[model samples]
Target: MKTQSKKAMMIGTLALMLGTALAACGSNGNNGSSADNGAANIQSANGAKGADGAAGPNGGTAAGTDATASPDLSKHVKLTWAALGDPPKDFDAVKARLNEMTNKDLNADVDFVWIGWGDLDSKYPLMLMSGQNVDMIYTAGWLDYSGNAKKGAFTELTKDMLDRYAPNAEQKLPPEAWSNATVDGKIIAVPRNFLEYQDAGLAARGDIMEKAGLTTLSNLDDVETYLAAAKEADPKVVPFNTGASVGDYPLTSFVTRKKALVSVPGLPANMLQFDPLETKPQLTSSFDDPDLLAAYPKIRDMFLKGYINKNVLNNKTPSRDAFKAGQSALAAYGDNQFRDAYNDINAAHPDWRVSFQSFSPEGPFIKLAYDSGMMAIPSASENKERALLFMDKFFSDPNYYMLMIYGIEGKHWAYTADKSQIEVPAGSDPSLYPKWQYPWGFGDWVGFNKPSTTDYPDYAKHVEYMRSAAKDNPYANFKPNIDSIKNEIAALNNVFLKYGGALAYGAVDPDDALKKAAAELKAAGYDKVKAGIQKQLDAFTPGS
Candidate 1:
């Protein structure tokens, strides 16, 4: 496990302590239909049903669960989930309606502590370190779930606990989900059953692309062309709303697509890369790679030409948020970021015609880590059992899960006539109640809904491609035991952050910066950290 500096720990602890009370207050409400009429009503109400005539993601039953089936729900409780993203308008009303069902069925009311994308890194560590009263928080491979689990920040969920408290999940979730959640022979989190492409791409305004006479962004060159045209078309908007702090560098996709390298999960900036197709791929550093060096000049050229924000290093706004707010012409990030950006931007400005262009549109897409998005109980949580029960309902109960993601149906969202997808309700401003995109922990392929079909058919197509084409990650189960080299890793990470962003964003001379960074990293024990990771990798099996 990694250790924090004395100064960082002190500051993080203080920040979390100060925000503990308000964190629980960041809550949203959702409404649920009664079990007796839910399935029938869903089926009869304008043909609003699932992919099949049935109601759930799978053709199981209707949206509601029988409240009386649970003999354990004798006392009412409240759960606080530390989730990502800002709550939409009417969140309070939605929360009230959602609590109505939870109160009836699980005898619990849930609150979400909204953590913005910009604040996630700093705040998440603080919450865990401070032992905040949050019952559950989002966890993933990118968020260092295994590292934190080893550090004793998360509760060790036993098989018996899962079978008893979250029976539906234990029974319905695939074996891979459980195995993915396991670290050091213990289940540390409840893994999301959904699979997605773990690749980066660009989200741009199709309307602007049309103005530029460009229809597609197939490669980095196309991205540059689009960025130039976008700026020319609208000088008021920044071409690319990217920053260095949150790893929002524009060249991320370029490196990934050009090299066809698979990123090592849980690493800083995914700096470690390897060829998955190689039977015994060796770990390599982006800093030392020739491809990264080659891309730096192109990125620097874009930066020098005023394509990116001049003060990006100090900017903390998330790239997607900047795009949605109309402050930037394009947002560059991952598949999930594209989905959220498309949903919100399309809702806010249907005329703008938002679209996503995958950096790797051909082959080499990798399967997302099964635990890429999950809900983990914090070690400090007082309501571990109740939290597990909530997970059970969120994953199993369609009505509850829908509420968590889409809010109250009529008020927040509406289903299509065919009942295969969702759409904005008539006369409702989608921007006001953008689909609740932050319930990632509850995202099960068996219960989730695809929204906004009218304005963005590409999103649906991309979803299909991800499910069908993405290959499983060869090192999905290889969680490196960094305990021995945690100090070296930390030092190397600091070296990268201090110099990597400058090189990536074109704020410094590539030649000078690269040499300086390489020297600093080597001095900081980069080789030792790499060896530590490789040692663990060599001893692990891919699908064992």
Candidate 2:
């Protein structure tokens, strides 16, 4: 039996202090379909689902879970991986292919365990506490990955282990990604390295924009312009689509400093100087802060004016569909979602011209914090080395990786003549599409599809635009020892859940919301959380 890791312990302690309160407040599955786990699904609502694996690549070469000097990796071992979102449609079929690889190379096999979206946060922790022999876990810093790492829920994979077993994974990821995975200078989890260009923008209905006498959607201010344009052009349509409680999952991917008001409540209490590198810092309430106070009426203004969907508060529409079917004229989401939405629209309405705008023209338009792509090894696994090895293959094995993420050839996805753009088969149910959760793929170095995107000149143009607007995050390495402010985070977030949307959409009275938000922040121990974080930052020098 493998012993509990320090990371798990810390996570447990913090969760004990924090998670319960959060659960009480509403971490309720914000998923539209009682099944959506807040995980960002960038692909269209239902383009082509990612295909299943056919006797795939990488694992067939290794044999066994031997961390010994001689490394006897030939023994067939069963390892378990747990994650919250849906897997590829070909998960079972792909599992067999991966098993075949393990049989060939490492002489090992894997057991796939899935946790439904609703049960993930609560159930995953209980499973870990029960001492289940899980080998690897998928984690994003924002999604409790680093918190669990700090709690000793995962083992540190030393350079020695990487050199010995998973060299491909080590080599494929860039230093930036690997560096982010380090806690106390030890690598505890794997950053799913998929290519990413951080840019938060808005997706506009090309047809609507044309009808509205508009050339393009560019800024937050332009939101009203587009809304008016869409409204004047068509009488029975909502100009924009937004949800009251929806977490900005996809938008966070492109923006630079997306601290959640719920995820990190203190956005209103006092201005906590957040570090760009260390994304795991426990945020304090900004509810009382002047800047945050300003955001309240801003959001309310939009809500009152009908710039957004009237039913936004109770909206359950799959984001892109609302825009595609002409229910809404725009979607203020992430660049990836925007791009993928464009693809979906093209597949369905091949005749329409579509495009989106970057985070507003007036700064504060975006910030990218923790990525959607993150995975961690479990502290309870007996075959961690082997688990990491398989993961390394998953990361480095492009053939298998693409097949797992994008789907099969000529069936679910078809390549353009130049093999640049991929198109999903017509009328494929969006639900059938795989969730791509085997391991979250962030825009890491591992997935550069030069051939896959050759024909999509627009995608290239978008990448360039994103590149120009993208800012290198400065605090990617800062991990707030939230051990001290654990309880306060949940409380603060509860208060935030009450006010976050009012400000974002100009729905609530700014002064009144600030009063309630500030009062609650103090009650929730905002000062203590800030001081804890500040002291840590003050004492440490960056890169020391």
Candidate 3:
């Protein structure tokens, strides 16, 4: 977020941010930050507000301003949106823009209710049952996408409605992905599209590596070398710092050689959306896998050698922040986190260099089943037409996309000499930066407006470079029917919780942790999930 308020700059920055957030998907089939968690039916933050056109059951009343019966949308419509941290700097301006656009595009008015960062899931569920009449909502598993779909918190969109009203959004998406979003054959959510893959990877400080006498880092060996160099250069800093939630990374990076670990989501042999495969309709969850067979030992070794920062296990600070502080050499994360921290690192470490790698092995990654981020129609909305129109304009209107993302161009940002770069516009106050998150719905990769009269390097090359490095996990669109194994899924998560973290974090003996978890899963119907997935895969063998 920058101080300017140009729409173009906002959109471009938004795209960059989204690309980073959704980099996992945009990069081919990986997620940059596990934070987006837009995986499979995870209701995305940017949901649909029904588009304007012919209205049917989802339409409003004639007593209101709608063409037919006017239902007094301002009175009846209540919407709730979920998000991280506080709203952006120009949040009011953005909402004003939305209200103005709503009046222009449709004849209804509405408001966006916000839910804070505090314990979202527990609170969101309460909100759902409160009968508060929320018109649209943001959801994910943590926010309960699957749970809510089952609980009937959202209204399902009829296919006819999508085609007739939201043809633009419907046409833009890849087909099978749409199929995965249906609950009992009803489209309950709007899927989020991203540019990069969502898989985990590494973020290394170039300056630290340079001092460590390493120019490139493709493996843990390089990381070790870099850490040693950093300590030698400045003993004050811990060469490595990690979150308790992410301890698995160092373990995985060491085991995989140069690749980042993958948590595929399908049955055995049939990879999930995260896998690299020509054919497969399944996903794999590496979280509980023995790949840690190697990962555990390596990470344990690092821990013993004091190669990692001493405060890692207790460090509640964000990994990206630690990197930005130059307290660590490598930050293990996805493309999403790296981007959020990238600018800061550049600013803080102007003399430093930066690069990334994955913690998974260098070869034969798993295929992930379909992953998703969603937007949903709140059962509470009365102004569906206006809401839909807003989204349509939001994605399709170049100007709106730009405005929502970058703010007013000349005031928010300026293009470089070659018109290749977007920097904070001159004379803008960095403190009052306007924040716009565009990647919420639009894909990670897109060109809002080309340079009119300049020729810098191809800014689009970064897109090309990432695309070249990507391979869609053929199973990216497949999702299994988990109704039969729903209970088991919960039980398994509990079991994994008990021993999984211990194993991944090396908090407990690896052998004991794996044994306990495997045994617990086995007794709790681990095979049931595998079989359930197998049954679906067999049904779609043609794709396999």
Q: Give all candidate RMSDs, comma-separated.
A: 8.7, 10.4, 9.4
Error of 1 at 386 (Å): 0.6
Local accuracy of candidate 3 as per-residue lDDT tens digits, 354-445: 65554442333322222345567666665455455455454457666656555656755566678654566666643233323433543312
Candidate of highest lDDT = 1
Score candidate 2 by TM-score against the native.
0.69
Residue 449 alpha-carbon offset, candidate 1, angstroms: 3.4
lDDT (10s digit) by residue, model 2, range 276-377: 344443443334334444444545576677766555433435345466676766654443444434555666666556665544333331123323245666
Could you estimate the TM-score for every candidate? 0.82, 0.69, 0.70
Clashing pairs in 1: 28-95, 29-94, 29-95, 30-94, 30-95, 30-97, 30-98
What local lDDT does model 1 show for residue 371?
Answer: 70
Best-to-worst ranking by lDDT:
1, 2, 3
TM-score of 1: 0.82
- Give lDDT tens digits, candidate 1, residues 437-467: 5566544444455545543455445555544
How many steric overlaps are in each model, in order? 7, 79, 93
